[model samples]
Target: MRHWRRIAVTLLPLLFALLHVSGVLHLQVLERLESIIYDTRLRATMPGTMDTRITIVDIDERSLERIGQWPWGRDRMARFATELLDRQQVAVLGFDVVFAEPDGSSGLASLQRLAQGPLAASPGFSEQLARLTPELDYDARFAQALQGRPVVLGYYFTSDRDGQARGVLPTPALSRDRLRGKPLRATSWQGHGSNIEVLAKAAPAAGFFNSITDSDGVVRSLPLLAEYQGQYYESLALAMLRVATGYSDLSPLYDAFSEFDHDVLSGVILAKGQSRLLLPVDPNLATLIPYRGPGDVSGGSYRYISASDVLEGRLPEASLKGQLVLVGSTAPGLVDLRVTPVGRTYPGVEAHANLLSAFLDGANVLQPNFAPDFDVLQLVVTGLLLALSLPLLTAGRAVLLSAGVLAGLVGLNLWLYQVQGLVMPLATVLVMALSAFTLNMVYGYFVESRTKRELAALFGTYVPPELVEEMLKEPERYSMDAANQELTVMFCDMRGFTALSEHMEPLQLQAMLNGVFSRLTHIIRSRRQGTIDKYMGDCVMAFWGAPVATPGHAELAVAAALEMTQAVALLNEEHHRQGLPQIGVGIGLNTGTMCVGDMGSDIRRSYTVIGDAVNLGSRLEGLSKTYGVTMVVSDTTRALAPGFIWQELDRVRVKGKAQAVTIYTPVGTEAEPLAPERQQRLATWQQLLAAYRAQEWDACTLLLRNLHAAEPGNILYSLYAGRVEALRVLPFQPDWDGATQFDTK
Candidate 1:
């Protein structure tokens, strides 16, 4: 019963463990926690230095302020692109902006309308408009600047169901028919907001510049391939990489087990005349964005060149020569900012730059489909081991164990991330192990401690004060439920108590009784560390080996019985001095199996013992008067306390018991063995008992007389003498086993 509470306490962590392992409870909180950890690790491991191979032509605040707010004329943009390609000699160029509408700033359409309307017959107006057409047609001028240049235009995909599609879309990276009958669950869009037809035709290649944010609104990863109208399109980063690497063909890489399975889009294979590169992606064909560092203009991972400088040719040609350039804006008014793991407000263009950098470097983090399975395995193994081991250990050991497990989990996760470039889900595993450990520690301290204190209070009086403190250390190990256990029980009562109470006034009687019981309880508990079960008016019932187990319980009970008798004698002496009636107590001790615990009805309950052993102790206490002895113990107790000197009283069947038991009285400890004179008398008494049982009446009478004469005040010898006389007058039975039986209790 005692250990059951501890076992129950240990199982709490397992409950949470099972829920997490079985996926019954999705710990969304853990996911958030893991995100925080991921951000921290990402920042710590980032190469804060710059990457010089790629350059960003940022339309920064300075650029915007210097070159009249945004919508810079198409002619000016055309000149900017032409300058980077021809003058600066950049290897490749990509735009992170869209040109969905024609540049109507030149008012070319208005002039043409005027020529065709009211001025239809005006040759002079027609000639002037035709002459000014080349300068006024800004869209054609920008298109001509883009022709024959290695430029990739950027566009966006719309997921809104009701959004209207506009402009022209480039050829799909992978046509719908190529992916027929395959299970591709890539992000699909219903409509697109793309570049104008003239710009799209002039650009060598183009890709969507859409950034996908997670549920938490952080742009951690992006789909490399998205589906629109059953056709696949590449991201701006992938398209740029392809153009830079001279990859002409892009195809889906499926899992090896199933070729036509669209759902198993492992990655995309970029091929250029037999040279190929496999880009790993998640199930949705998304790749994690490997951020270099915070995208600062001065000392960040990528160099940022002001668009104004590039337009005005303020920078050296060597700076942009052979560099892969990405034209984007970082102005606040542009609203091209995002929340990223590295920075809260990050320029969306820098995200594509980082992705491009990762693709070229071949360092993109991969999250395979089996990562969640790994997470679950880690969570279950760590959680279950800790739950099972912690309960059996001390608080300090449990703490150490939990710390080691947590450290192992964190260390393994970081190792895989840093060394192998594997981005596993660390949040779920870490949170489960941490939560289980923390809950167990808290339960032990707050809940388990409270229960222990309560148990200590309940059993404080039942057991000795010293034992009570020991019980408090592990309260769960002890319980007050009735259970069978081998123990020692004792019953001590004051003789002639009824007559003494009748002679005294009620107050005097109460005072006397209280003093006697208090002194006797102190002897039983303080001397031998026994449990005081209860007080039956004139008798004190006590036991040992309950509430807390003690190996020498029988020995302690016998020692306490002797001390109680001595304590009563001292009390009698004080009573004689005060002219009060002297008191004598008789104690009985027995050792056997008994049921001990809190027992009673709802109205009241007590921590006590019950069984034949307890009954025998009470009956032995009653027989103390008949034998004229201070204390009597059954043979079981005498055997257990071999260190004590004893006198065998008789073999008798006690009241309400069918079996005969040998009873003895503990005279003193082995430290003071019996004297030779008392030893001689004991021998004579044994001989007299044997003769009486053998029906030698005359011989029994002679031996009893001599024993009584040797010790005239020995009432036990006189009682045996009288018993022999009574037996002589009755018919002796052949089956008599020399045992006495009492019918009354």
Candidate 2:
């Protein structure tokens, strides 16, 4: 159970991070909000102006009144055509009117007989019948004017499924049978022909010039081709284009922008590279027509001659040379007015002129095929980059990387649009980058804060005051599995602390221990170079090397030990003066291999050292009492502190050991180097140790007696003398080594 708990703690961070990243929980709402945000952005960023040119030719109410009602007589239409062809020159003429029924004025008696059917005897019925009989037959004269000339006619389609189709339709420009397989919304018309005889004999080709208005009444696109009765007929604009370019087949492309050359019909291509004008439309296939309004003389970018003035021969000959002329009514009451940005009552014919001008000039807005595809690509790239980078970098670095990714995506999109005429979605990519960055940051902050809280929870009381400084630096390092490294370990305990505790009440004893440990803890923490691993009642185990590394760990540890010994001395003096029992502390120092890391159950842990080295350090602390000294260190620590002054104590095997380990005491002050006299005394002690290890009992005792005479209260030298006397009594064996032993623990 304990092991499982430990493992769970170790993996908690990773599991939490995975949950946040998977987005199976709270992230759905975030994505939903992001989509709304992107849509709003697209609406705000829509362009104000389109880069296309189109024109309209209006059949106004004035033209209707001036040219004799709706259908002028055939002779008058022929005269209108002569004026256009002989005087004012036009590049092209497209008719916006259709004549589905035949002219009946010449057959007046037959029309009157047919009119005698339903309400023949009603009042004023005879006068009405007479008026209908004398009406002019405009079909004949219009046919004469169309002879050997390029003219296009207009017709409309009906949305009603059972539309009334009248008159024979003109021959189809393309087949519509294959289009039937695909499900499509088709426009059905009541009638097809605007002129039967006139279109058949006069015009070279005719087109359906039906303006399929949308519910909103905007005209953003024109259906260059449509299907009817298993046949596809061209529009009036398309027929005129065909005449101008001399092409027979027109293939429409749906995805790409329309393009044209000098040969309009053959050279036009859509988004899909088909040889047709692919117009971009909405769900309704309609958009607003940004019209430039009507011109004064019907001579905007093209030549427009008045019908009356042209018939009077008031125009010059040079102006009409080899030009395509269009004859249409321009009178106000003709009801050919339209609404546009430039004017509300603009002529409709000018719209067609604008389209011609736009095609001729090659100015059009190209909606590319790669835009939506690029948007999807941007989303994938942004999500992937953030996912990979966020986990591996610091908060600041992650933020910087996220910013770079966003900038790159946005910059690339802008370049594609500006340089290659591609329109890609920028909002999705931007949102992805920002959202990933923000979420990762939020997760990181939470993780870091949790890690700090964990550190404080586990190590706040167990670790030494000084180690807390490093823990605060980047508390995450104290997380489970913090690595063990080389370090200096120190163990300190109050001598006769058990006896002192027994003499006082439990509360009083705890208060005293707390007060003493508190002061010692302050000293350790103020040094800020090591952590006190833990306290065993009045004992402290500290080490320098985990959480942070220190190069002079041995030197610092030794300095701290010496300062602690002095503090204890002052404390004891104060205790004695107050008639309280004096407390002595013994400290053991060792520099060796030990594992310093978080060690314990998941619920409770301590940052401490463990290994054979730690046991040796504890054994050395016990030996401090045997020698009646306050501080002692193993030979390992002596070697590590090369600049510090150390005096030899003895060479003996500590409890639970067969191998003898040498111990020493720090005798140096704050001064730079040892005095000559102290150096000489240390040299004598080194000789004494060599003699003792060689089993020269007399020589070791002689040196120790001299050391005791020089410093009579030196318990370290006296203890060595007692050891030398005891070794002389041992029975010699052939395999027996000089290494000593401690029988008691």
Clashes of each: 5, 40
Native-structure RMSD, model 1: 15.9
TM-score of 2: 0.41
RMSD of every candidate to native, in Å, equals: 15.9, 19.0
| Model 2 regions lying over 4 Å from their true place | 1-74, 89-91, 101-136, 176-201, 210-217, 251-315, 318-348, 361-371, 382-745
Candidate 1 matches the true fold with a TM-score of: 0.60
In lDDT terms, how accurate is model 2?
0.61
Q: For candidate 2, write residues 658-739 as lDDT tens digits.
A: 7788888888854767878778778888988788777778888888877777778776677677778888897544464555
Give me the candidate number with maximum lDDT: 1
In candidate 2, residue 326 scores what lDDT?
Answer: 42
lDDT for residue 527 in candidate 2, whole number 0-100: 60
